[model samples]
Target: MRRFRARRRQEPTNQMRYSSATDVPQVVPPPIEAAAGRVTESERRTSSQRFRGDIQGLRAVAVLAVLGFHTGMPLLSGGFVGVDVFFVISGFLITGLIDREIGRTGRLRLSRFWARRVRRLLPATAVVLVTVGAMTLLVLPMTRWSSVAWDIATSALYVVNWRLADQSVSYLASDDAPSPVQHYWSLAVEEQFYIVWPLMILLVLWLQRRYRLPLTRAMLTGIAAIGVPSFIWSIVLTKTSPGPAYFVSTTRLWELAIGGALAILAHRIPRLPAVWAHLLGVAGLTAIVLAVVTFDAATPFPGIAALVPTLGAAAVIAAGTVGRRTISDLVLDTPIMRDIGTLSYSLYLWHWPLLIGAAAMWGEDNELPVTIAVTVVGFSVVPAWLTHRLVEAPIHRAKVFVRLPGWAAVLGVVCTAIGVATAVIVSLAVPKQPSYAVGGEAPGAAVLDAIPAQDPDGRPADSVDLLVPDVLAAREDLATLGGEPCISELEGTELEACSYGPEDADVTMALVGDSKAHQWLPAFQRIADERGWRILTYLKSACPLARVDIKYEDRANQDCAEYNETRYDRLHELESIDYVVTSQVASQAYLGPNESQREQTDAMVEDLRRTWTGLEDAGRQVIVLVDNPNPEHEVIECVAEHGDELSACAFPRAIGAERGGAPAQLAALEGLDGVSSVDVNDYICPGDMCPAVIGNVLIYRRGSHLTATYVDSLTPRLDEALIAAMR
Candidate 1:
């Protein structure tokens, strides 16, 4: 009786008897009878299911791997595969429960099932969201608050996955720091599956009953219908757009479907011999461990690579279902494992925000202490245990939900909705102080005239009001070409030449290179307007005008190289072009392999020399505006956090000018005809230090690019340099 048995009854529920006085003979069809018998058996087996310790243990392993990966353990770099394991387990358990429900009753209780899910998940989730919202405001910079608030709101509504997918693709948002609530994206994916899967099952069950199809066969067909296409799409999108593919529900559905398939066919699967079961379980465990160690950030993920761990998890589950005790079952069935498994959901929810909050409080450069990390993880258990005991346990134990009046249930739902809406409103309503004055005298003219005497170490005595109501918005204003169609973006259409300045100006000057070159456009545009000169701009994001090939995110930038070549050829053909101005992030240059910093710098200088010499040879005057000091962190973010005392955010001139300065430019322009190099390093860095604010203006918008407001202040200085270089 304790032995595992299939859920089939030996006898049919209803029997047909032959009548003694029969005008017509009564016949029993064997096929119809057998089908009826099978359905009855399935129903019986479904009602007598036992708890699976192996599944609970599997949950423990999955959560541990995820926790390790998130804690930045180098050995568990690929532990993200744990999510795949979780998906499979979820699929198996949820499908099993639903199948049993359908077997016992003719219809699925959609409302009751969903209510259980909401009660189990939402209460704890809302608490985490609220806690994260408060922490984000207190610990993180105001610059991040707006985004974090929206993320929290979306996480509460269980749609953060789509938001994350959108953000992953946005170039502007690419450099944004991770949110405290970012882990909720995974929960969002699972919640979405919960919403759609039951309806799908309902449809399948209805079809099976109406069409006289076998229940198991019908369910398998439905699962395959969704799973197969999803798997194929996952492969396609992972190759083409890995960022979005990684987080989206569609790409991840097949992983869950694998578990569902196993659950549906559990009865049909043959039991393995003891030796084979042990071997399979061990192999499954090995595969999971191997994936965690071997896979890294560079690995093309969740594509063919994902099959390793998913199949491994599937194998372990399958092994546990049959034969003698498997290695996985033995290892995973311990009391501690079961307890951790019970607390897995809450642990998953609590750990991420704590880790992210730690990083935000202490900058990323300073790793959280191992002891502190352990302590924090330990502390997370307090909340996890409390949440499980106080919220989750009570909800599951109370069958009163089923007996509650419909109006009472409706009121509970309404109240929950109101609570979530209120949290969102409160998060969004947090006020930010305005820092920068808008509509002042021309920032460039004012700063240039007012810059105080340099300190003994060469730092400027004057501090600028870089802090604004919105620093990012002000930084966006720095680029006159923010939305210009001609500025090529990644995957943009064919490049077109763009022109600015006076339409009928006699003299033509060209500004060309990456975004760094584009940043100088506002200053040059002002010069052009003042002097009746035509300005032609050829700029692209992350693409330098240098002759050397560039690499981004470990891939060769073929588009950048091609654009540079084509643009160079076009520049040669432009007869009216007199002056060619160029600048770029000098440190980004890729010299061959194993090159030291000096060697790379030298190689970059040589590339610049070749490009500038070509321009001069073509009867064009070359003016190289030396790239600005590169700050190691976002200047605006620092200014936002430390606006009252901007010096706290200042970096030494030695570090700021490490990449770009007079040395590199002079080396490139040496002995070159019709070419000149100009640098305002003295003004930019002041002396020993480069402060975030200079002369009441924010110096840099992001890290290196001068804020348009700051650049406006530098026009008088820049004009003198440009006029001298041209002469």
Candidate 2:
């Protein structure tokens, strides 16, 4: 766009300035067959419409920011908000199309509209799903294969967002590997929204005809009816339940609605002056940049915090429709930006999987070298461009779909099935967990615990080739007492103690602490069953028995404190629960900020001593079960990838035990009244090296936690230690 003081001046047309369908071309929806559920709509634009280069440029910025974040660029830590930007853009474009369609036809041709969407989005998505499925088998660990398979199926049907939302809050799922198709969540949300938004508009139109109401006013009312409740729910859920809040559709509905409302009224509101448009555009761009740089993984999202980017995107869109030249014209309307924007959807789909594959192959996470990062980014564009040229563009613009949308519907089902089939194949390949333990002379600790010179049965470490539990099945190898979890969930504040052994046993023991204590139940349960002793377990995720100022989920964890206090009161009041045992995953516990490692260790030890002394005062004999060695990261995942060379994954015991709280637990009990400490780590590691597998059993699961089978092997040693500590 340009302005001149000379003769003639050419200015951009505000294409959104339509009051009636007569002002725009009528949409010709293709014929279609299938109906969708709680519809999730793909992005759509009106045919033969005026080109808004500024909007395309905005799309470029959004994708680039996301790419920057995914490709190991720390500067754009908050760039994940690019998905929010896309939602606003989708809402505005789709709503305008709906309003225009109703104006011309007096009704929505839903099947035809769905047909067009299918042809436009499904082909590219299915192609990516198949490619990712093959990649998963070739590169990723088999443990990840089954989940990624489900991810593919859900993504194909545009429901991965719901799946991710469910998983986000599950304590069991928190440590699972990230699926390559995780980014499809945003697409799922949009599709689900489009399904409902159109129906609401149709209802509003029906009411408008009966009441003689202005169409725009009725639509605005409809927008508010959905948007307001969603915004309030977003805030509440974000504060109390941040995990699910990030991925759920209900929390994000308001952002799209804001875009829809703007599309309806942008023409009605007076256009901004050129100078004001420039300033507003600059402001919006600046706001987006600031958000991209500042926000991080710990940032509570899709709540009130979302307003900055969503509103900033809205401002840019609003400011861009000024007809006169603005600051956005100089930045957003370039040829390069428009070209990238045209391939944006494909780029979004392809980039994440490529990055994930890169991580599996050579990188731990997003810590790739600059050269590797640039290569991955460059390669991602190749597939995006190829997909656009061969699949997305051709199928979307094809004449056959224009004539027969019914075929498009059929093709969409087949495409979705291909993704489901991929999932089924992967599921079928998942190695079943053997009911009985599978290799050596009661292997694991016995070999390692042997005195090197005297023990004839001891074999060299990592000698066992055949694994007891297969790598894929090791995920289910959880520590259990009577087939139930010992720990309460991350959000749980209750003191619901699970009882084990006989109800009328003469000896009653209480086990209290976090997941670290939960991991010991397999061995403890054996000890209880043999000794005819009853056990009461009070455990919570990340809530150690230590009375420390713990932080979780980016805030002060009042729940941990509340639960610990409740547990203390119960132990004090109950005379029957005379014996107490506890341990913690100290390195895993997130303490307050700005503290050195030594400072944190001191604080944790002090808290532990204080907590156990209280137990001693209650006349309860206290035994601190020493925490296991922390491999610091996922050792099972490492084993799965390098199963043949098991020794490669073996970490040093000294380092792991330090990372765990072995030293801290001992320090807490040093000369403290009635409090005794028991260490079974010698049986666990038994030497300088912490073998990834011992006695053919996998030692770690997803995190640093020990496998139940391995813990079961330590039962006799653990029982001996407990008896000694009791005396």
Candidate 3:
């Protein structure tokens, strides 16, 4: 899973966007002699099936675009548009099938239609789930097992899209890795459509029969009623909360409805002249290509931007319907394209997990080479072909419950049960925290001084077993800082204030900044409790207290600027505030126009000087706690994977120094009166090498923030510094 940061939005993978509907074969006419009204096997086949060679080719195009995008091809940054194409295709085929059935027979066979869908899709899906589940336990780290298992379970139930939508907006799971089954969200959306659409058609047909209304009119009315509101909601939500809007089903229904409307109006649409058909086909293909090349992760999606691809797909389908031989018919009907289309469903299922599993086996930084990615995609054919032959074909061909016994239905139930049970057991077995003997005294200054320095290779000599629990449970430790309304959100500018310590204490010390300031709350609370001092907290997620504006997701963060102004005014109004403490991750700051790095540094120093001078003029003391060293990678994940040889996770002090705290703080507070700066980097990165563990404690939780357990151990040193600053 890509880490979710407010400024660095991770683009969703292909699985969240791509799904392939199987091709329905053309049916031969049945002989007369059956009952006049009774539906024969041939009549049922003809009603529900069409051999659209052009559509098959389109499936091939959709899957390949998704594959190219996922494998890191620079040319296909907008490869995500392939999903829009898929939605159009799904709407067209499904609507066409339903309409044909109505034309051939007076009433729809809802039970038989659903049964066919199960045989066509479920068997292969179940097999893939079981295989992926087994691979997850064997290949992925223990930390990811629980999340993946739940994803698998929900995927089997066909409701994982909703789960992903919730996770997308959740602050707690923001940095969670992508699940192997994350791709199932798109499939879930399609399945939801499959279930609801038939019922909607049933309603339309009943109304048409009861009132003697035209079928096409009724169908069009039903589609418009659902689609119009959904499109409006999609536009609004994409601006407000893109993460959830991208995964939720309702936001995407309009694209599918476009295809459904096309299918209903296919006959009424005029037959195109050869020149016009050719031009429409070429233009449509061009639009799709342009969207794929130009769009990127930053584009506001499934809103107005989605029109490029969805409308393009609709144009191509419409062109092919009227023309004698359009470009799609002639070019897309090749052997390779048809074969790939035949295997598209299985291929879509297999590709994503393979990519995720490969990332897990290797480190996240290792870019999957083009050759290896191609080979991996090629290897997918084996499982895909096997699944199609051994599972999908057998179930569909068995014709069980149609005319034969109910063996196929029984088999489907058993497979579903097995899949559910496997997911449950695997999820439950994942340990929340590693087993470590839980008794360790907090190391005081004397104890810290006695610890041995790093070896020549920069590896710590002490045992790291005590830190295992903290590493395994880093997220829990991070939660000690109150979340949500207590601390302002990343996009929020609200001046929310929280307090700790005795309410009646005379001395009131205020802590303010972004998350970096929040990290020190546990230690500050402990110090306040011991000394009977009151602690006030005003913290935001990504916003720092610096006067300079910052950018988030490629746009200026106006909210952060507003929050800083409000906080400054609030601080000035509090006459009894005796001390102010501030710290922030300086690496998050960026320069404004005409501001060079040196100029920005000078500007920051001036801002601090002004703020500190104001406090001093008001007779209040200020302390600047320097930010901690940020590791090059996620240290907790590194520690979890390399517990035996923890030295492998040690980051060079030179690199940490270049990227982090000391220089920035020294420059900002140089020669400033009434402001005292304190750095704990010596304790964190002892002997010029920042090992993952120090004094048998995990140093940093996610990237730079100190774990609450480690911060608790730093109480003595922090107390000494604060008392000296006040004096």
- Per residue, candidate 1 scores C-alpha lDDT tens digits across 422-450 of 45764665554455655543343344354
List runs of model 2 lying over 4 Å from the truth: 1-49, 365-371, 431-443, 446-466, 502-506, 549-562, 588-598, 641-644, 666-674
Worst 10 residues of 3 by lDDT: 26-35
RMSD of each: 10.9, 8.7, 5.3
Whichever of 1 and 3 has more lDDT, that candidate is: 3
Which ranking of candidates, highest lDDT first? 2, 3, 1
Lowest summed lDDT over 10 consecutive residues: which window, candidate 2?
Answer: 6-15
**TM-score to native of every candidate shown:** 0.82, 0.87, 0.85
Candidate scoring better on TM-score of 2 and 3:
2
**What stretches of model 3 exceed 4 Å from their correct place?**
1-10, 16-50, 210-212, 365-371, 401-412, 438-446, 449-465, 468-471, 481-485, 488-495, 502-507, 545-580, 585-624, 658-676, 723-727
lDDT of 3 at 483: 39
Over 4 Å off in model 1, which ranges?
1-48, 206-214, 364-375, 405-429, 436-446, 449-478, 482-498, 501-514, 531-582, 586-625, 659-678
